[model samples]
Target chain A: MSAEEWEKVLWKTQSYPDNHIPARYFLASLRKNPNFRPYTYWPLVLASCAITQHLATIYIFLAVFVRLKECSLDPRILVWITVACFIGGYLAWELLNCSRSDTARRNANGTKTLKSSILVFLALMALSPVLKTLTAATSSDSIWALSAFLFMLNALLADYSPAKLGGQVRERLTSVLSMNAAISSSVVLGSRLSDGLAVFALILFSVQAFALFPMLRQRLQATLTIFQALLTLLLSLLSICLTASLSATVSCIYAATLVAVTFVAPGILVWAQKYKNEIRGPWDVAVPKVN
Target chain B: MDPLSIAMITDFFHPNVGGVENHIFMLSANLLRKGHKVIVITHSHDPDRVGIRWMLPSLKVYYLPYPTIASSATLPNYFTFLPYFRTIILREHITLIHAHASLSPLGQEGILHAHLMGVRTVFTDHSLFGFEDAASILTNKLLEAALKNVDAVICVSHIGRENTVLRGQLFEKTDEDPSTVAVSGNVFVIPNALVADQFKPSQIPDVSQPSSKPLCVTIVVISRLAYRKGIDLLVAAAPRICSAFPNVKFVIGGTGPKLNELLQMREKHLLQDRIELLGPVRHSDVRDVLVRGSIFLNTSLTESFGIAILEAACAGLYVVSTRVGGVPEILPEDMISFANPEEDDVFRAMSEAITIVSQGKHDPWNAHKRVKGFYDWFQVAERTEKVYESVIKSDQRDLWTRIRRTMELGPFAGLIYVVILIVNCVFFLILEWSIPREDLHFVWMHWNRDYFIELSQKEARKTSFI
Candidate 1:
């Protein structure tokens, strides 16, 4: 058809149907995957490392529970190890802070972190006895169920996106919910312990695992890339070993999950890239130009 | 060509008034004029008004008592409307189901049920949706499912067609060649039309009579006061417009959630006397509202075939609209002053429009003539009829061929499509068994020859009056 023949004019009716598109003019304006961003393997693997660290934290908490049940780990030794690690972590954090250009702001942040840590430690110590009896009437079956549910919630709701890798607190409700559930499960489980010292140890361990650990991990990943990767590998291996000490079946499951998340998931994502044909064109709602 | 018994399904219709409602009503009326039987199916907004009512002798509207959930859209209970919709189809002897608006649950459901009943379906998309947001994502997915088996998809503009194709995932892909982009053959671009006779330049006062006092250049804005309409931009630019031109005023119409913000802005600027908020105007009185202003300002952030601007042009008002979505496709540069959807840009465009109107260089009567010649409902109806014809012809293909076409979407989507098809087929069979087609009575009120003669005579009288 000629250009004039294709021109849609209201005054003069044409011989062709209203919807007739000449072969040459069909989809002349279509643009496919104009803004598509392809994924790289290493970045995806790096992002999934957050999930590995989160799982390792859960593993350490469970290992502490198993040791407490067997009476194999002394509360006194646990307290001394926790205090020494806290002091060492604090010193390393301060040294890292000193490298920043804003010394005054770094010092303020250091003071705030120290003050908050001391306050949390004292609060957990004082609340241990109360927590020991708080869930006494609740059945052991219910407590175990609740703990499982909370742990699953933490795993599902955890933010695994690289956008949160900037050390900025992008705390979604899901993140807060997951953290609270993890702490509350520890408290409920701690209540089942016979001695207040054991309860105190459990609560303190949870505070460090659920709260302080994520911040340090995020900071490490943001500031030191190679060290973060090494830490992820070390944590994954330690968690696997601890799970194996608990039960062979549990260890096998943990290893399988680790492989699926870190390796299999990225492979699937890369395989699916061929189908990513998101077409954009002038027909899209114009993103309004703002001056 | 045989006249089709068509059912126009939507969640928006009379008792509610907006662009989509007006478009459906006008299109139905014009289709009826062309000797087609048209019935509208919409969710009832008013409790007192629930059953069928005749809007015209031929145009019957059935307001089903389905509770509206949000934004006048019915609750999207997938299969709840099937039996009732099936009953209506049988009673109306509907050969074609023409659904309006993608967001309407009734529209989507009607299309699904119509396809199961072996009737042709055409969906007209009236708005543009983004691909980024969660709500848009879910809506696009649902649209894709609904449109998977639809015979044809009609869009009001080329951009709208593109958006619909993308949202519906209606592109055909070849395995060997990834670069080739072929859109689905069912999509069509058909711009909305205006009732030119209703909105005529003769409604305006004679331009030859010069007034002793200079007329205040009133800029009219007629749109639902929604955030997407860019009412915030209008509110922000109002003060600047008022301060820049001494003899400038605004006449705003339509009611919505953003009314209070507009009132607050008016009070803060204390331009109560300058800006006239008409609250809402009936569709019949839109031309009256347009004639009161020298310029019509459309600060809509997005539009798909701005029918209000076309109406304004038909009523002899110079238009100033945001160059977003399909707004840029509606008019020539001389008829409208384009602006970005921002405060400064809109303010500048309004000021420029005021200057141009005041200069009296371009004749508004010419704009009216051009718009009238460009958009006529009869032409729109004829084009729409051609689409119906083509789809009805293609609907003759065997069931296996249709199923294969749907399965080509993707493996997972194909599985879902097959399941939906099976469920729909079962439900349709149950409905047929329970309510036998012989039990349903077909209404032939529109088939009367006198009605057609009277309609043509009325149309002729309207043209002669104009």
Candidate 2:
């Protein structure tokens, strides 16, 4: 094609067909992978730790339930252990907050947190007897099926992202649904237990697992990187050991999931980057410059 | 050459006032004047009227009784429209199926069904969609599916062509070999046109006449008050513009959900006297509104083609538009004052345009002549006719090539498309068996020979200089 013929001016009529694509100008404006930000192995692995922590929490919850069912651990002892862990987590969170420069801006509200925690404990204690008999009339088969479905809902709906982008109503809804499902699952499981004390210990452990634990873990992960990775490893080991004490098959599945989530998924993502071809050009809708 | 019968399918048509609707109406009318039998298929707009209605002597519209989804788009039922669409195709003897607007499900489905029936298809994209959002992703995937086997794809601007190719995933990427990055083979850049005669400057007040008293420069904005139109920028820039040029006034037209926010902004700035919000002017009154202003301001954050700017220019008004999408490609540098889609930039550009117009530095008459010569519906129809001719002349793809192209979309999408095509074939058989070809009568129509003779004479005059 002649140099003069290659111009894309619209004012003058040309002999070529309107859909005639000249080879020189064909894909001339295409820009491949314009917004591709390179991903490293470590950051992706760190992000995947959120999934690992969630799965580990689920495994630990199931393990505690099984142990309670077998009466392998005392209900009072289990309650004491959960209380000690909650207080320790609170102190560690406060220490982390004190070390941070934004503590004043955050307005650490220790008294409010304490008050809410005490209120929750008292409420759970009062509700245990009711929860124990709540699903007694329902058959064991239906109880197991309902609890299983709720647990699945919790797992599917949990927010696993590291950064909490503010005010996404859909994300907030999913997170709320996940919490509600987990709490409902715990309530149903508590009703399955014969002892009211066992029900209380199970509810308290669930409150720690579903509600306070995620906030503490998120804080730790945001502030201390090494501590977050170490905590992930520690939780994985604990979940595996606990699951093994119950069933070998469950422990094996947990180990396989841990390896797959922590190592295989990130590897797949990094590998798939090779096939990423997002074309951007002058034709794209320009991002408006905000004042 | 024998004139081709054409079917224009879209959900947007008359009763809906927008750029795409006007483009379709004008193009179809021009095609009819050129002696081609034209029929438009769109969803029913009013309950009182639904079947075949003739808008012009040669132009007919078939409003399919289908439920509308969001924003006047029909609900996407992949195979539901095939029987009726095929009947229209057969009855009208339509050789070409021209689908408008990527977002319109009726248009996309028309293209797909036309292709399945072995009829040539052309798709025209009118808007720009980004790839980052989920909605765009889904829409793009659907576009990819529809355009995979289409004979030709037409975009309204060069940038629009690029966007269509990208969304359709019609390019290949290779670092080692630039030649391997196969460009979209059939994508075309055909800029949208306006009815230049209708937008003549003589319809309203002339911008060139200097007043004895200090005259307030009227800056007109006519668009749907939507977020994508950059109404927020207009809201932010209006007060600053009013303050910067004390003799400047604003006349805004069109209505949308964002009109309340603009009203609130106007009240907060206390410039109700300076700003006149004339909500939703009819399409016929657009030129009347445009000639009342010395300058036209468009604050659209994204646009495929700024047809409003062209109409404003045709009305002999200087244009100030955001330098996003295909807005920059529509007018010459002298006729337009370009700004980034920012409030401050819009305010600055508006102030600059006001100064330029007040100083009599730009000639509105020359701008009007330039726009009139640049965009004409007859020219658009002729170009579209060429596309149709080329598509009809091209060799038909065998079944395997069609299936392979459809399967290239992705595993799941490929599965869905394959199933759709299979069902489409079965449905085609069912249609053929139930509704025998002899039973469907061809709608006999004739065109005014004098009209074609006049159009041919005009065409000859247009090409005489070339």
Best by lDDT: 2
Quality of candidate 2 docking, DockQ: 0.37
Q: How would you class the docking of model 2?
A: acceptable
What is the C-alpha local distance difference test score of each model? Answer: 0.80, 0.84
Taking the true A–B contacts (Cα pairs closer than 8 Å), what share appears in each candidate? 0.27, 0.46
RMSD of each candidate?
4.9, 5.9
Over the stretch A61-167, how does candidate 2's per-residue lDDT look in tens digits? 98999899889989999999999999999888778667544655456577678789999999999989999999889998998899889988988888876543232
Summarize candidate 2's per-residue lDDT along B1-466 as a digit string, tens digits: 4788889999999878788998899888888878887889999976655888878545788998998878899889888998899898988888889999999999999877886566889999998888877898899899999988888888998778877887897764456787677665577778888877788775344556644232678999999998888888888888888887889999999999899998998899898998999998998899889888889999888888888888898888889999887777777688899998787788788888888888867666677778888887888888888788878889877767878888989999998997887788889889999998899987775556687689989999999978
Pairs that clash in candidate 1: A283-B159
Worst-scoring 10-residue span by lDDT in model 2 chain B: B205-214
lDDT by residue for model 1 over B1-466, one digit each (tens)?
7989899999989878777888898899999878888999998776688888878645788989888889889888778899889888877788999999999989998876776666789999998887766898889888988887788889887667767877898876655688775676778777888878787764355567634233678889999998888888888888888998889999999999999999998999889999999998898898888888878999887787888988898888899998887777778778889997777888888878888888775466777788888878788888889889889788454567667866765798777766776787788888889889888876655557687799999999999999
How much lDDT does candidate 1 score? 0.80
- Residue A166 CA displacement from its true place in model 2, Å: 16
- Taking all chains together, each candidate's TM-score versus the true structure is 0.86, 0.89
